[model samples]
Target: QKEVEQDPGPLSVPEGAIVSLNCTYSNSAFQYFMWYRQYSRKGPELLMYTYSSGNKEDGRFTAQVDKSSKYISLFIRDSQPSDSATYLCAILDYGGATNKLIFGTGTLLAVQP
Candidate 1:
């Protein structure tokens, strides 16, 4: 199975709607989880990071992790047109000497105004 899996969705929602993106992983060794947002033809910028199983919230973004189920989710409130972008879920494996990040197939989101 893939270390990390996410549905590469082109999800569309109206402005002010709530958006939820998710990912699943098979590796239990992953200790850090991160969510990144990327615009078309641009690099991704880190939005949130969580260590282990917990929930982290910042502004309109919230990241949740369930280590037992190996599932993670990112929730966005009051979604705006500017929130339209590709969301990537990544996990950091600390098993090796050099920690490496495995990214999921990003999900594209469009908030129509």
Candidate 2:
């Protein structure tokens, strides 16, 4: 299996809906999990980062990691049109600087009016 797997979701929902985006990984060495939000062609902005497991919350965004299940998820509460963007999950391997990062294909989220 690929190191990480995620639905490249062009998931559309009306404004005010709660959106849930997720990713699954097959690697056991990945310890750092991150959630990024990107608008159009711009680079991603770090939304949340966790060293291991548990949940992290920031504003309308919440990130959850379950190392035992190798799964991660981002929950956006009270969605808005401005929240329309691609969400990407990234994992940092412990290999060193050369290890770089592994990214999901990214889920395209559209919060409609």
TM-score of each: 0.97, 0.95
Q: Per-residue lDDT for 1-113 in model 2, tens only?
A: 88989999899999999999999999877889999899998999988999888999999999999999999999999999999999999998767555677899999999999
How do the residues 42-71 of candidate 1 rate in per-residue lDDT, one tens digit apiece? 999999999999999999999999999999
Question: Which regions of candidate 2 fall more than 4 Å away from where they truly are?
Answer: 97-99
Q: What is the lDDT of residue 107 in candidate 2?
A: 99
**Worst ten in a row by lDDT for model 2:** 92-101
Model 2 steric clash pairs: none
List per-candidate RMSD values in Å: 0.8, 1.1
**Which of the numbered candidates is closest to the native, going by highest lDDT?**
1
lDDT of 1: 0.96
